[model samples]
Target: MSDFTTTRRSFAKGIGGTITLAALGSTASAQTAETWTTAETPTGNTLYDVERTANGVYAVGAGGIVLHRTDTGWERVLDGGPTGNGNSLYGADVTDDGERLWFVGASGAIGEMDVVSQSVDDHSAPDDVTNNFNDVAVTGVAGSANAYVAGDSGKVYYSFDDGATGTWDYTTPGSGSAVNAVDFYDARSGHIVDGNKSVFATDDGGTYDKIGLADANANFYAVDSDGADDVWIAGGGGMIHHWDGAQWTPADTGDASLRDIEVAGDDGLAVGGGGVVYGRDSDGWNRQSTPTGQNLKGVVRGGVDVAVGAGGTVIER
Candidate 1:
């Protein structure tokens, strides 16, 4: 195992409210129009992931913070739950129609929030599971009962009835790798990336097949699919892999640990450690200037591109 595996695993298990903003400033880049702008957040806690909801954008982070973007700015919609553990929320996803939101975080905590009613339901992990849930992926259609949550120790839980009726079915890919992120092209097909620098795909929502990679040590932190044929995976050591329907291939982005990525149409942006931000277009990948030096953890494509990171940093284009 790589040295990062141990350190990242420890970091994931540790819980704290303190967040330090890095001193690194924006680096010189080719795209110099200053497309990115910083927005104010309610807390300095580290934000792990962001997703585009129907009404606007929602960011999840340390201390169970959930910030919703309004027409004016960002607002804290949810703090620590009833237990007050303030378990850090790691990843979140919105249903395709944008009516519901699902989030996963520390100690296998799962939450579902209604976009219209603004009601939230906090669900606890089963007795046999105690590992932190790192990410979640929901189906595309409204009232869809299928959703998948993945996390530490290759643990994965599938809720065929949307956790409203039956209990969630669980499975592990047996890689024993910490599943950092998951994305589904549809209800039946999906992909997962892990801390062991491995990737897997599932078609029946249960069994997964390991996908071979050019670099065996590439620690993937995030995965997204424009379609089953077109998929992108980003990770540590500045690694980005593209799956073109059949196989995975490397895409150059220097040696930076990319924590999250967002792709829209033919354009894509990836942000990560050291305030690193890269944009890809028809021309290719070009480094983009970030306003803050904090490690960017999550990004989403919308009317404007927005990226969030440590120390309550929010950057929009």
Candidate 2:
């Protein structure tokens, strides 16, 4: 195996409790008061991913916990869904219209939720291909019918039927590094980032090409795309990298390990261990104040920005 693949596997195995040690408490003194406000959660489960839905925001976490935010506030939903299995959900995505929601998690679990009908369909990896799915992405306005899930051992699965009635086809890029996240900039172009400091891009859905990175030790956790040529990746050691169509450039975020990222237009936010939140703009990345000191795991932007993490923490901006 390549050094990159081996290093990533070792890092993943030793990441437990790292987030707690990385959090230096809230840096509220350096941030403005208008930046973030704490929201209540029904459980103390560690939330792993958040996404903007048609009606509001949804966050998924440990213990089968799923929370939805509407005008009223955040409420726990999907209690009877796959979350009840207690598998830790790691990533989520929604259709452009917010009518369909897809989430992937531990033990090869994949879930699809119908927003309007309040129903869920769940699937598991084939016995021969069992691996923990870390992230999921949906492409096109056609909804969740066409989706991708990235996971351990460099596994990537594609489904053309919303994962409701058909089997998903699987592929493995060359690295064999654990894939942390995936995003599609268009119907035919997508990107996946792995723990091995590698990025893979695909334009035709059948093949993925590894994109070179300057730092081979940087562990990327999440990825987002604003357009066909603009992409952002965030991860270990406060590392943030941008892809501007031709090349990847590192954007500094101090020393924190960013776990999730969301971008809308030129605006973007990355959240990570120790409640660290960084905002991006024309001036580049800047740290933002958050109300909690808990380790943040996921962030999403919509009518409002919401972040979720350890201690069932939830905050909005």
Best by TM-score: 1
lDDT of 2 at 198: 78
* Cα lDDT, all candidates: 0.73, 0.70
C-alpha TM-scores of all predictions: 0.87, 0.85
Worst 10 residues of 1 by lDDT: 1-10
**Clashes per prediction?**
1, 3
User: Where in model 2 is the C-alpha error above 4 Å?
Assistant: 1-33, 80-84, 126-128, 141-144, 164-166
User: Any runs in candidate 1 off by more than 4 Å, and if so which?
Assistant: 1-28, 32-34, 81-83
**In candidate 2, what are the lDDT values of residues 165-237, reduced to their tens digit?**
4566778865688988887755546778887887777876547877645544568888776654566778888
Residue 146: error of model 2 in Å?
0.6
- Scored by lDDT, model 2 comes in at 0.70
